[model samples]
Target: MSLSLKRFAVLLLALTPALIAARTEPAATLAPEANQAVTARMVYGLLSDSRYAYAPRQLDAALEEDILRRYIEALDREKLFFVASDIARFEGYAGKLAEAIKGAGLEPAYDIFNVYVQRVGERVAFARGLLDAGFDFTQDDEWRYGREEAPWAADTAELDALWTKSVKNDWLRLKLAGRDDEQIRTTLDKRYANLERRVRELRSDDAFQVFMNAYAGALDPHTSYLNPRAADNFMQAMSLSLEGIGAVLQRQEEYVVIREIVPGGPAGRSGQLQVGDRIAAVGQGRNGAMTDVVGWRIDEVVQLIRGRKGTDVRIEYLPADAGVDAPPRQVVITRDRVRMEEQAAKSKVLEIEDRRIGVIELPTFYLDFEGRRTNAADYASATRDVARILEQFKADGVDGVVMDLRSNGGGSLNEAIELTGLFIEQGPVVQVRDASKRTAVHGDSSGAVAWEGPLAVLVNRASASASEIFAAAIQDYGRGLVIGEQTFGKGTVQTLVDLDRFARNENQRFGQLKVTVQEFFRISGGSTQHRGVVPDISFPVTLDASEYGESTYDNALPYTEIQAVPYQRLGDFSALLPELDARHRARAAEDLEFRWFSEDVAKFRAERARKTVSLNEAERRADRARDEAQREQRQAERRAAGLALDEGAFDDDGLQADERNVVQDVARQKAAEDRPDPLLRESAAILVDAVDLLAADEGRLAARVLRPGRTSTVWAGGADR
Candidate 1:
């Protein structure tokens, strides 16, 4: 139901049996369909040992089939804002699938088609019902493809089909806005014809996605299979820029749909190109003849439009309207690279009530791989830049700093150690354990301490890998405070092994598996595996906790405790915890709607736990009714709390106000417990308090300041990965 990465990953892997059948039961009930287990030894032997043959490990057909089945089942588990009836229909297809997989002949496909047609009929009926019920699905943000890369070119037809389906889906949401059944049916008829023609011309999403899997799986999973044009676009994405009018386009039937005009780029600068416009024709330069691009492969169409920077490219487009009477418009745009500067790390100083705290939002720890190959600065450059910003903040006398690592996917491992070292005097940053149980402790070999201030590491459901390691180490060493949601529970380390290294011939191509070998552990005792790196201070943000952690993944390793390493505490901040708790409670009480939402979400969970799918039409209708009733009950409760009774009300945009409230709440809590945070207000306050305590105890700070390591020179024997 939720689109958490953990849930989607399970869906992507498709290795869980229950996922294949739209069931949530344990896999033991299904036949023992697992492939031979992928072991650390097998992976290692393939990489390091020479005894093994240079071949990808082979699996039996049954196992491969099981993998696909499980993968599909897993995808269905996320609920993904799919219409409940569509979901029911999808499950209904599973029966036909089971029969088809077990049996043979056109009779199976014919029977499946009968069920499929009925499902389509039901879809049309439900679309009308939603219209009658006053729902507006199209406007729902969930309809937008969330944060994934643009779909490649082979998927043009699929994209078109989705656009067509989305039109109907969106109409259903709109229909819920007090429309009569007559009007609804009329709208549905138009949508049905559009969808029918589009669907017939395009491949089914299931088949298309399956083909994608095979194609991508053939290469390295990271190296995707894009159509010739999507391939060009993919190259641009890697370079962090793109040319050709700077508009993200998609193929919708005969139309090349404009998804978004890149902000500040050519199309954006043109002040004419708009999102949701379709290019029916294109012309190069100012005087070239207009070439009809309708039905052309998206790439061929793009070539017709692309030209030198600052050169004009004309696009003949129709505005995105399902209505037939809309006229086409011509717009001219120049070509330029769209720079993604927004994704770069940004710094700000927050005046949290009385406390002044510095916040560094690290979106992603990115390293320019190409730049690094050319011996240009990499993550080190970014870190150095951030350090300069921190130094400036220090000069401004901010109390503490919050390194906002939320949603930060990992980058260079080298940077992780270096960043950790920046805050502490030379010591082991993290202890990495390998398959042989050999412990390798990576230390801050750099003797300099760039920042010695009180630190607060902020993370959430999306914080992962290097983020987890750094947070865990800081918590373990008592160097900083970890605030906000738990870090993503990905404790395993992956080493990219070139599959070609073991390939038997020039054409010996095999996909690489990002095999997990070593696991990470806190210096204290715990491994951030299934349990993840839990914050010392916990705050609730999202309702779908079960949807986002290592526990949600079937193949994830379990958490365990390790022997604690002896490490010095940075300073004592534990005394402030009680006051911090009190302040948080006081702030949470003022947010009445947030409180009500929490209660309603709990009820939704209970409802979800009680739901089951069946094939009978009457039973399915009853289930739909139950779901609608539950939704109505939730709405009534929200209305009682004085919240608006809008259908698509609980959106991220609406949630921003609540997020601000929560931020304010946190600010208050931090202020109550500590001084103004440049790194961590609570930590700084604790530092101030410690300064007083140490002064009273007679100059302990001078005695505890760590000295440099015994030796600083590098050895001739080896270099690190």
Candidate 2:
């Protein structure tokens, strides 16, 4: 029997809840709306359909068990709430979730959430009580902070013991930060209260989205469900013009953490805000009192941070890994639209050993989708801007060009092909494989070459999806040298399906689902799925490939190969690679900036590898003191080297020394904009090496520059000659 049909049959035969229920209904039931039921049905129907990239796995008892486990994990990722007894009680419904969803019965999911909320309330109350009692800093007891892989507590007594240690840790952090008893109590009371309030505020839709996403995520990490409000937020994010501080926020425990800073956005250019920083409070204008946001909903916090364009929004944040009692720092950002100028392709000329090399930093493969559909002539795109940059480079008589795609998370797929077309005359860029195994080749038909000169593409671990496509095409065609670390290996394409479209009623509002529909492969027959494009020349990076790429995701599609598409190759770069690598290595070893970067990366990796933190108050204080001393020493070194120190270089308080110093702000921005990027500089040097190598090999050099009317010098799929 078909999996869907069997699933339906199982649901019909197993509608009884007697096996799991101790009561007739949950203590607090926030029932799903009728529209939500319809939405759930539609979502399941779509996933089971042939359009999804992966084949539909049978939603039988075993799959249902997996979904239930995933849902629980999503709700309490760190095993902070819900004891072993709670988990055991929920397991009765593990194999029955498929049946429940089949009949649109969402009470089980809501019941679990209701219990989670109650648990959170109880824990927060206990934490508040402990805060009042204070902690003994001299105690030698340790706290295992990393609990994601740990088991749940056995009972309330066990949970109480855990909460005691957790609360004590928080107290110790504040005590070390030099807070007196009353001050620590005040801060922690508000934090716990916010947590309780946020948990109590969870609506039916929030629970539903969380549970449904668990189901979708089990199939693929990239596939997700977004509720109506979240759907709107997603669209706004894609538009890249939100009137906010321009940082994506997520709730992490009691804090709203900065997930990503939108490029070209206020926070992106600020040089103060960073990913993983916790937003503790937000205020309006220059003089508004900051309101603490700990334990607040992400959307509510976002509303507080967002403002009208050009208006100032003040933010107070705790640096990532900064102890709970670490003084919060504040920054004032003038909210503005995240326009193309911030994310657009930017050009700079670098003089490498008397040869002028042009560098274009492409932050993302962005395109104005709405404008293009409306046929707006002024529409902006990465390819168009890059073409202009190449023209300017030609006019300036540059020897070579470096396309920097470092830290580029990728965007429009069409732009990737278009950008690749600017380097090669005409060829296939990537191939798309759908659910049914049918493959369609996407190629660049534009015959015009933008810059037929020496080209090198620089990428890093964050460079993903569309970035991978462009880099792969360049390497495949021998059109350019791919440099830096391996790409992020996200080769799948997702299509957002609005649930409202499939609803029966016109007035009914349903959420959206971002479903993975296709996987991309390089024209050379290799899939960039879990094995991102390997660089021809590698650079050292601190980020572990296993921890950061598509491989990190459970059930990610494996890498494979297909028949190679026919296309012309530019020239052989094999002989040139050795000379290039040797020169680059020697230069990197001798460069002070590179040495500093290497040391910083090593330190970062070492810190990340430490899963357990010293919980002893004295040890932690000593460590913090040592770190502060080192930071001051670094500042002194920078001063000695004649570099200007940041205004907050030595401030213990979170507030900037001069909040309204417009001149200093502008100077800092300019300095950041004009700062020499070590990686980019190295890439340009590598391109110069390529130029010199080609200059010596006249025959191979002629092959690159003297291409005759898109003729094939080498087969696209075959080994390079």
Query: Please, what is the whole-model Cα lDDT of each candidate in the order they appear?
Result: 0.50, 0.74
lDDT of 1 by residue, 516-570 (tens): 4566677776788766777766655442447666677653566767787776655
The candidate that achieves the highest TM-score relative to the unseen native structure: 2
Worst 10 residues of 2 by lDDT: 1-10
Q: Which stretches of candidate 2 lie over 4 Å from their true place?
A: 1-29, 139-142, 168-181, 242-358, 392-399, 504-508, 628-676, 696-721
Q: TM-scores across all candidates?
A: 0.59, 0.77
Model 2, residue pairs in steric clash: 328-654, 329-654
